[model samples]
Target: PPRVRECVGPPLSAMAVQSTPVMLGAAGLCFYAASRTFTSPLVPSAAGAVPTPHLRAGSAAISADAPSTFSGVVPAVGLLAAAAAVAGGRAATSTTMRRAAKVKKKGVRVVEGKEIPWNIFSPKAPYEGKVIANHKHPHTLTEDTGDANWETSHVTFDHGGKVPYIEGQSIGVIAPGPDKKGETPAKIRLYSIASSAVGDNETSKTVSLCVKRVVEVDGKHANREVGEDKPDKAGTHFPDSKVYRGVCSNHICDVNVGDDVLITGPTGAEMLLPEDPEANIIMLATGTG
Candidate 1:
């Protein structure tokens, strides 16, 4: 990456004898080289000329003290083109960032006078809920689960009436232990609550989540060390790729009847049901909304 300067060439006065067409062609090449090579155009000093860069790697830079003649115009035009290119690129980038910043979060709906339970348990303080039921949904069931195309589960947890949530709200699930980065208490993953405030058992003491086991190839952890674990386990290996299982979703799906899970928040007010009984509701969702 070290810049190697070439020896200084002859004065532009001597080159002025060249044909006008030849001088113009050289000026065009100069413009293209300057625009492609540098973000800041090279400026000729009051007493000296601009550096004419050679396109190839390690090619020496030639300096010419451009006189007040036709030959002097080559480097001058190139300098202007380079500066314009850099300025235009920066302006486009600024416009893109401004457009992205304009996007806003969805507004929370207020139906006359309905109280919204927003963040009863936060990420800082989470609720411990026990698993009441974890079963495969009938829609995702296959004759041979070993080669099942897709696996989705309906997992219910016992909140002990402490964590109350309305229908259409979501709860955050924190996977047990240090994550792949060795950070203790992995980050929370939110899933929509599939049950109403009274719950599936109608006791108002439980909450449920619909989760799909996520299995896919991940190139991010390709260089990570995979343990000598079974293929059915988390770090399943492939011949030329790395297969990853979802940390939180897999944990929730694999949990047994009595396993305790860290739960946070009956959060999100945007999806709350309108209080009006006769209000028309049209829901359209895919996968696990």
Candidate 2:
């Protein structure tokens, strides 16, 4: 018989488990308060009861011996409960709206034009342009001090003729060399153009892309202490791993000035700017959009 082994590692930690009880307690309190407010008015109304006297504005020294009825108490409690429910509901709605607003701020909002110019150049056949400049932007004072680094490159491609494009269009960039699978003919990646229609230098013969290098730490092949029972296949000790550089972004960022890059399509129409000059515009962007 073959030996079957059941391998188990460390137990997973649920960070959110601690907050569950607190959240349930608060919800239970709100429910209990609401239920009490609605059901407290169980007393019957007084028959042939005298209407409560309306107090005047400056009437001090009023009757202190006035009878208090159960009917009055019930209505008062009901009114208070209704007011509380309304106020709580409004507060919750306001909180929800604020959260949604914060999420919206993270994404870009654009008023687009009706016309969408499609496929001037396809992926099958792409236009080649010379890279005039490929350089990193000036780092902020705060960013210079931090260990967390983000490299943003401004790449300019010079198209011999005018490649007419709208404000919010994107262009395809083909990385040099084969993919990870050793496939020939590199994949085309679409990046949004940072420059205007007239180009960065106002020459109408060039375009630019604001590219951020995407570096991700691969944990699957991460270094771990070799077990006595399960030794490493290579019998070698590896140190803590480094991040894997993105293929397309690395190629774009590393391109020197005067290098020719494959370009395709002044594409996308959904983000084009509205023609109306006086229109209210709200643009939300993060790290160069």
Look at candidate 1 and tell me the lDDT of residue 126: 92
Q: Write one digit per residue (lDDT tens) for candidate 2, span 62-99.
A: 23353433445566556656665665666556656876
Q: Give the alpha carbon lDDT tens digit for every residue of 64-149 in model 1.
A: 54232334455666665665556555655665687697874332233455655667787888999998753433322323355321
RMSD score of candidate 2 (Å) = 19.7
**Cα TM-score per model:** 0.52, 0.49
Off by over 4 Å in 2: 1-117, 134-149, 220-242, 286-289
Local error of candidate 2 at residue 25 (angstroms): 81
**Candidate-wise lDDT, in order:** 0.65, 0.59
Best model per TM-score: 1
